[model samples]
Target chain A: MREVFQQSLRDVQDRLVLIAELVEQAITEATTAFGSSDVGIAEKVIDRVEEIEILAAELDQLTIDILARQQPVASDLRLMVGALRMSASLERMADLAQHIAQLARYRYPESAIPAGLTKTFARMGALDVEMARKIVDLLRTQDPRLIAEVRDLDDDLDELHAKVFEKVLSDNLAETPANVVDSTLASRYHERFGDHAVGIARQIQYFISGSLD
Target chain B: MREVFQQSLRDVQDRLVLIAELVEQAITEATTAFGSSDVGIAEKVIDRVEEIEILAAELDQLTIDILARQQPVASDLRLMVGALRMSASLERMADLAQHIAQLARYRYPESAIPAGLTKTFARMGALDVEMARKIVDLLRTQDPRLIAEVRDLDDDLDELHAKVFEKVLSDNLAETPANVVDSTLASRYHERFGDHAVGIARQIQYFISGSLD
Candidate 1:
């Protein structure tokens, strides 16, 4: 019975890493779709999000089952709880990625994005990819430092977001109104995606340090 | 020692409700400020968010103490976990209210809301209030039905959000570019605020049913 519970635990951990990988792919595709105005890629990300949701629900059931049947104690309980928290964060990250894709598809027909705007978005995407990688690393290694690094990366995302805002407001007043709205919304979603990533990092920190800070 | 732990639990529960009330006030102020373009009310919400943060951290510590000292078993453990989860959702709700206020202040210098937008915003605000009330009632009563009611209210918020999206996208295209951007961001923030409220409702549901729908 102990072995069976341990196997389920191992399965949950493996599925978590898989979800992280899928999130990374979804975000990358969504960012590329935004940068290139590729509706097809954006549509793919939107379609794949259902798989993320299914994985999340299944993982939730697994955690609840482990808690109820195995009756995890002490550190084991913490790990199971952390897994549950991580799943919610991961699911939200997937949703944010799908949101970005929806916005990208919404704007694909209207205008050519300024090169500078594309560059800013590219920087944001890089930060997102870095954050996702660190989350996976934290899961694999259980390293606490990477969680702090994730918070630092979020600071970089905020700087990029501020730049996007200033550049759009200063330089794009004469552009067609739809173009401005689309670009601004895109930037805001990217910033929010970083925030959610940082949230996941915080959950990892709580798991490692047993502290919410 | 048991009595001490019970007292601490009650303290934490009281603080949670207080935070919820303040957050409700913040959302109310945010909605009114947005409709009236009242920067003062917006700033008030932003200022009070710090208090919510402090309460959130305090609640976190209290929960940890309850778990470590009381060593709650069975449904008691569930109650402790539920309080921690509830604090997290409420903290985020408070943060969202602050963000709405920030958006209001951000667009204050040139208040150029289009016609009919305020009514839609007002309706969103009503839905937000309803959602918050249902969540508070659930927390206070521990009644399972209120959780479902909260979910039902979230559906109404979703409908309002879709209507706002269509109205803003189709009607605001010919406005001055800055006005269009500001209004778009404002509407997006309001829509997201509704989503966060739904999140709170879901958390309440989890507390009652030990599952999320």
Candidate 2:
């Protein structure tokens, strides 16, 4: 029975890693689509949202089933709770990626980055993609060091988020209201993607350290 | 043992209601501060965020304890899962409310509603506060009927969200980029608050009906 429970725990971990990989793929494609104005790639990311949601739902069911069958306690139970949260965060990361892709699709012929803010947006997108990659690694390996790495990445993302606002509010941009709205929303979506990444990292940290700090 | 589990379940329900009530107050005060540029009230809402978060964490620990102690299955198990999710939604609702209040505080003495969209923002704020109130009621009563009510309110809120974007993009507003940024973010925050409210309603629906639809 103990071995069986361990297998179920491994199953939970594998599923989380799978979902995180999908999230990484979604964000990578999403950033690429947003930066290059590639509508086709954006459509691909949009179409995968439902797939990620279904996978997340399945993962939740599996965790519930494990709790019912295995009744894991102590560290094992913490793993179950963390699995549920990590799945939710991973799913949210996918949704944010979809939102980013939709922005690119909305401005198919035109760029969503607005004038004078393209480089800033490019850096922001890169940061989000890197964060997603680190999340995938963190989930697979459960390395405590990656927790701080993800948090530091979020700090950088936050700074870029503030920079996006600063640039938009500055007089030198000469952007239209539409550009301002899109840039604001897009920057927010990117920043939120990083936040969700940090959320996942925190969950992993809690599961490993038995503390939420 | 069964009776003890029942009491624990009741405890879970009561805590959820308590957190929901706090969320309702947060959104109510937040929208009021947002509308009136009342920084004092906004600060009140901001200060309570940690309170809500702490309550949520305590609820999570209690649910985990229940799961470990009683090993509830089927409907009871669903309740535990739903409680975790509802707690998350309610906490997110509070965070969104804080964001709205921060906007008000940041633009103190200067309304964040921009020039032409004041009425629209007022309506949006009202919808959010109404949804928060309904969430508190739904958590307390577990009435499936409130689920539909919450969904409909979100629809109204979403329409207002779209209208805000429309007005922002229109030429007649003659607003600064800062105004555009604030309106976009404020509208998004309000919309997300409604989304979290809908999320809690859905969790209730699932607990009652055993279907996620």
Query: Which candidate achieves the best DockQ against the true structure?
Result: 2
What residue runs in model 1 are displaced by over 4 Å at the alpha carbon? A1-12, A65-77, A108-116, A143-145, A172-174, A206-213, B1-15, B64-80, B142-152, B171-174, B203-213
lDDT of 2 by residue, A90-180 (tens): 8999999999999999988888888698888888888888898898899889889999998998999999999999999999998999899
Local error of candidate 2 at residue B42 (angstroms)? 0.8
Task: Give candidate 2 misplaced runs (Cα > 4 Å).
Answer: none
In TM-score terms, candidate 1 sits at 0.83
Spell out the clash pairs found in candidate 2: none
What is residue B54's positional error in candidate 1, in angstroms? 2.5
lDDT of candidate model 1 versus the reference: 0.76
Q: If you score just chain A, what TM-score does every candidate get?
A: 0.90, 0.97
